[model samples]
Target chain A: MATLKDVAKLAGLTTSTVSRVINNRGYISENTRKKVDDAMKDLNYHPNEAARSLRMKSTNTIGLIVPHVSHPYFAEMISNLEARAYEKGYKILLCNSQCIHEREEEYIRMCINHKVAGIILCSGSVALDVFDGVDVPVITIERFLDNRTASIECDNKQGGALAAEKLIECGCKHLLHVGNIGTLSMPADMRTEGFREVCERKKIPFVEIYTEDTQYYRMEYDEMLENVLQKYPETDGMFVNSDVIAAQTLQTCRKFHISVPDQLKIIGFDDTNIAQLTTPQLTTIHQPVKEMAEIAINLLNDSVAGKLVAKRTVLPVNLIERETT
Target chain B: MATLKDVAKLAGLTTSTVSRVINNRGYISENTRKKVDDAMKDLNYHPNEAARSLRMKSTNTIGLIVPHVSHPYFAEMISNLEARAYEKGYKILLCNSQCIHEREEEYIRMCINHKVAGIILCSGSVALDVFDGVDVPVITIERFLDNRTASIECDNKQGGALAAEKLIECGCKHLLHVGNIGTLSMPADMRTEGFREVCERKKIPFVEIYTEDTQYYRMEYDEMLENVLQKYPETDGMFVNSDVIAAQTLQTCRKFHISVPDQLKIIGFDDTNIAQLTTPQLTTIHQPVKEMAEIAINLLNDSVAGKLVAKRTVLPVNLIERETT
Candidate 1:
């Protein structure tokens, strides 16, 4: 087996420099890093990460627990996080908790056992006690577990307000907001609150309906949305908390023979791929998914390095105007 | 730190039994496993995976490299793969290559250096030499790198033929097939072959159009699709290789004022979330993604255990008929 010395000799670098590059330590230029990487590849030399991690007491791995990646939002988030983590010489240990609290707890325990550098929790579980004894840095996305846990989330409240404002500006008289039902308070619930606040201030009569957790998991809201449309026949505008639900709303509108933008203007949160794929393409509140992911990874990295990071990060959202409005 | 002996004493089991459960080396009953797990959790005992992996010469980690998880198809695939791997006591190191060959190679080398038990390559890279000196077992999904490499793929040819037949049965006159362009031959190329054979047999006039790699990466085919639709104005039935492209075709049809299921029928591949989220709910060829993932993991496990495994396993596909048909 080739050693670090062989790789250094091949790359025309010192042993210490090669070691620093291998461990991803302080300041290595990109050109020099590339040279070392190529030399390591050419020599088929692989520094045993197990031994190195044992000595350093941490692996170049980050644990990312998400409810599920099948959702376009989380899917895109994972793509961005994984890419960013890789650029930082870190690998992501992916955990799909499927919104199960026990599963989420198990994954956290597993990450701790593996001595991951940090954990990024996006599972939507409100159980704050899961991180009771975890020593690793924990950064959350969209879910604020406790006061101490670092979180990176988009401006969901502003997103909601933006959607409501867009609908009203499009000549909507009676407005409706569809949101998910949660037992405990979550940062995402602010979306509904912001929408409600905007509607009240604007003096626009609006109704709110919450879908059960089952609907969110199954990614089906056609029946609930159809029922909402039936109950509120005068609803001229709708703002859904998620693009998936909003897309279903569009289908429901088609089923009821209601034309979008003409009869019922609609807006959705989480400008995921579904927003663009829908016919009359959905107008939506665009969450900075990539930016949030990058920030979350950086925060986790900083926290792992014993650098102080802000407890909360809220990036702004944008109103994406499309055919729906 | 709580020692293994303490955990064994707390669980009322021998240290050897606790070690067995921790290492996942030998069979243990569910009741005993639960007891050990509970006792460890109560004691806050975390078995150092780095030390264990060093002793065993392999870590309980599987490197999963996909083109991009942002794509709903790969997203769902990663979800299934991660869930199944976790069930088998393995963590997934997610690497999204974005279809970049150099990045894919780098990730592969990193996985090897990290001593992953196996690698699941879902990236659509055809470079055969990248795996020349890889010591770990590699299982490719959807791409066949070489004859010796193990691969788990869906019956692309059958999927293609099914879509073609479904479109023909829907009373479409002229047929159009949209596929991706690739320099090297791949198992996915069989999809086009199957479609071509069915068209030749049916004596249906069909035209094939290929999208560039850039389009695939960008996940946008609007302009190319629009051009195709304009050039082939007589085409009424379309079969797109992916749901993303098919969704774009739907948008293009809407742009052209072409009514679906009335003036045209479209069938999509992969049956991802996009298929269902589309306004008309795309009819698609459903690849058994979960089953394929499960099989691939099991095959990798078997290979790692020095058990005989098949070189190629092709699962069947089903045509999901929806509003588009």
Candidate 2:
């Protein structure tokens, strides 16, 4: 309810004088600044943001887009990015696309229209063409676009290799790498490349499982993996692409009476909260999501300041051995 | 790299004309709009946000403060709030306080300085007196403040009562309500009242196991509950205050070889994603988080437009049945 006019009138000064003090624009006496501050507290004056944003071209905010915040991947990314952005005195506009491409574009349009300092993309299949020739700086995590657009991704290839190596060390013979590794779905490439390279070097027979092009969350891959295990009971080792996949595998393994780390030395990616929730706490490869998110926010901030950011940034991954293998 | 001057020069107009085009203000011809749009696209223009914010007073964005985005309870709230806010063409500024009072104050100050349209407090433990004379409209969820301020919360009494009735129906002789009830740490008075009321009516003996004042999360509470179970082995039916708590109860029960429904039927609250993640699934109370968020935004929007809003908005809660009960 308080207005700048109220504070100015109470301070017995011109509104422009009050404005200068609040915005710290023009020179004003220290005495007048103190008077204005006291009057503002008394009047509870908050400079109208809607009005002020019309003059200041930058809101000191960034727009963040993700597929699902409840999902471990996005949740961790959001917390990490939020802490980092706050440290830089910047706020984050969180957008949950719910894994829809159109929703992702909707947020992008809003970010452009609002003139955010930077836009960070953490999820959704955002096409590079959409950002082609766009004016604002765009940064992607786990997804990459045109050359100007920067990217921060986990070394999924390394994660894949780690899981494979762990499974083999656990004395697994027959292995089944159940996941979709294609061009459209971004990180699958690094993971599949790593998994395949390790399998080839080990001279062990491996089977591949692919799903519908749209199954980005691995929900659709659950049933397919169930069938794979049923069809190949001799498969002693399973390298799951995600923690959620490994969780579902535990449930299915329970149904089939397949013991984990005994009959199935399963290794999952993304050490999400669910990784620990599963029955045989999933042996997972931990993606440095928090570190990556912090780095992404910094990179976006630097780019907004017109600093050169690396075209590609890769985060590390670790194998957290738990109950399952 | 394009500036307002460049756009104006290319459009054969003044700098104010380009500013008006970007702001969507004043009377401008459709032809002029088209020409400005074309010029902006051709020149790859991005109007600086700070300059615009200086005039607008409000940024057409809302600030959301939560404890942690990685937790299921807050993550669900974030996802729900983002979905609803997006539909209303409002963006969100995320602030994770980690349940620290100082961090919450920092977020509040940041929101005020940035001049966001309004703020939504998803996690609150701050003294209501601290925000007594603030200028902006703040809506708190699951936390009550001064009578003058607005709050959107689930009918906690009903949720507690619902949990009690379900647990009683499961045929347990003696039961205990697990959570920090009415303590400043959690301040979950509704659950406490609901369980006490139901027990009094049924003449069934009940005990309260309040965890020491500490942070609330699934993993942390799981360890606490494990200790509580050892102290009160007679506690057969549990009216746990959260789904994450219930998930841990199930895991610890497994560790102790206490088969649920057979030995200890459990009922949790807040039907978060963790409900599905838990084995035997958790039968919990459903809080309409998305609708609550939508109302928070609408109430703030009305306040900005100089309209009255309800001081307290209470939505209905439901009992979702699963294996736990």
Candidate 3:
């Protein structure tokens, strides 16, 4: 229940100016409008008029914000989510953030303006501050944003440890970890920590490499993988953040005449469709993607229905042994 | 420009009943609402009230309907389309049809209700009849719905023929063409036709196989590919419908101990990210996905501006040789 006064105070602006921005009645510059909008979002302030109208009607739609649907992981998640949401008589408003911060913020504002019943944020780059004043119910996937918002995530730490153990069990001497550029912001970074801990416990040597490019596409991953292999030719075990990257790593290994399993054992996270498509089918961590998607939709529905839901729901992950290992 | 009278006439209902459904002003039954909505859609009936209000203010949004974002081809298309649309100061409201007829129809109605400036339909399952009374501008991708609606597609026939020629040039004896169940609806079906034509002209024997399941997910595709390989053990050259399937074909080949390019020279359409991810990088038809996406968005914008856009805009496709063939 943040008020316009609170928004004005947070933005350091006059109440009248905030009201004008809310009504869109005055000649306001783009900067002022953005500041006001940002303040309102930070305050999670809902204009009384909009809030009352939104309550009076049911939109039967939920907003979904993902980094990019073109990415296999998000695409599969969205597919399962949309099907489940449709079964429950709701449609999804898909917002592709494309890993762009400003676009992600814009989509959040648009979702509120359109009166979506709730929002599901799958984009990890979005900062927690942006959700400070969001009025609608939010369910975050994989990323922990706030103490109030509900989040559903697979056990990244456990999965990473499982990968490390499996690779070690295969007698892989040297290990390598490939991570994303913005790795620290995401809870998935727990995977790297888990791997490191397991390697240290086993007294095995390991090297870590991260791509300079963003996580939205996998093209740059192959180049980075090549550089890593060149720098650390003895790397016999590799743990990639995603199956997409692992697939690229496999392709790069083929070019270098590196034999899989015999010479190197590779494990990937998120056993998506691409995992099986790899030459020596990827031995990877299998997250309950469909189940997680179903739970996310239900959580949104529960929040929309004013039910008290858990703030964090962590699902278990398992290792799937395939030809690569 | 269709009137309420036309919709009422088409639905064999009174104007008042149709008006009630349109405005949601009365307690209308689900059956009656559906009939009224269907009739309005059939007549391409633009509700005058919605049109008038929409013209007064720009919505800055466009509706995009695809079979499913999980499908790599569509996912990439959406990624490019959204980026281009954003550059043009517009946002996309994504609708995933999931090959459900009713869902596709419902999304159309929802888009109309949202007052989107235009729509881009990439779902092949959507019937041409549904667009009869669509009020907003529409640009179809790959599917040619009507004379009035604009469409963007790659040269599927040329791409298919190229696959046939490449496989033949690689000294393959037998050939197979894998297709989707809804082949007739999509212009991409021309790939199959072209492959067949080239095979016949070259005096090469070929077989065609199609999955009964829809094209959204690859589970059925794997099953179908297994059955195809089992039935057609002598299949040496294959021209699959998409790179996703090509990747699957490679995986299945591995399971059956059939080496690609040596035992079976294979080519696929839509050289997506997964194409390169495969070990023997897919030798396939490369459609200008990004350019096509940009054109589709521009066509929608043109239509929204009442500009004379072409009915069909076919982009060229090229064969990119890698390791498979």
Candidate 2 lDDT tens digits, B1-325 = 7888889889888889877866756678878877786787678676655566666756667888887788877887888787777755567889988777877875776678777778888765777655655667888888766654588889888988888888888887788888653455432577778888998999889888765435373246767778888988988898888877787788889899998878998988888866766677789999887788788888887876678888889898999998887
i-RMSD of model 1 (Å, 1 decimal): 1.0
Cα lDDT tens digits, model 1, A1-325, are 8999999999999999999999999999999999999998788888888899999969989999998788888998998999889878889999988887788888988898888999999876646666767778889999877855599888888988888888888889999988766564578899998898888999999988877767877788888888889999999999988898888888899989999879999899889988989988999999999999899888988888899999999999999899989
Model 3 agreement with the true structure over A1-325: per-residue lDDT tens digits: 7787899988889999988776545388788878887886565554533233344443556888888778888888988988888766566778878667777876776666566678999885676655554567889998767654599999999988999999999998999998656544778888888898999999999998766546444345766788889999999999998898888888889889999978999999899888888888999999999999999989887887779888899999999999888
lDDT of 1 at B52: 91
lDDT of 2 by residue, A1-325 (tens): 8788889889999999998876555478879988997887667665654455566655566888887787776787788898898767577888888777777875776677666778888766776655655576788898756665589889988988988888887888898887654535676567877988898899877887765544554354557777888788899988877776777777788778888777888888889877776666778899988789888888887887778889899888889999988
Predicted chain A of candidate 2: TM-score:
0.84
Q: Which candidate is the best by TM-score?
A: 1
- Chain A TM-score values for every predicted structure, listed in order: 0.95, 0.84, 0.81
- Model 1 lDDT, residue B189, Cα: 83
Best-to-worst order by DockQ is: 1, 2, 3
Name the DockQ score for candidate 3: 0.21
Which stretches of candidate 2 lie above 4 Å from their native place? A1-57, A129-137, A180-183, A211-234, A301-309, B1-57, B129-137, B185-187, B212-214, B217-219, B301-308
Q: TM-score for candidate 3, please give it.
A: 0.81
Which pairs, if any, clash in model 3?
A43-A133, A44-A133, A44-A134, B43-B133, B44-B133
For residue B271, model 3's alpha carbon misses the true position, in angstroms, by 0.3
lDDT of 3 by residue, B138-168 (tens): 8888876775468888998998889888988
Fraction of native contacts under 8 Å reproduced by each candidate: 0.94, 0.63, 0.50
Q: Score the docking of each candidate (DockQ).
A: 0.85, 0.41, 0.21
All models, RMSD in angstroms:
1.8, 5.8, 16.2
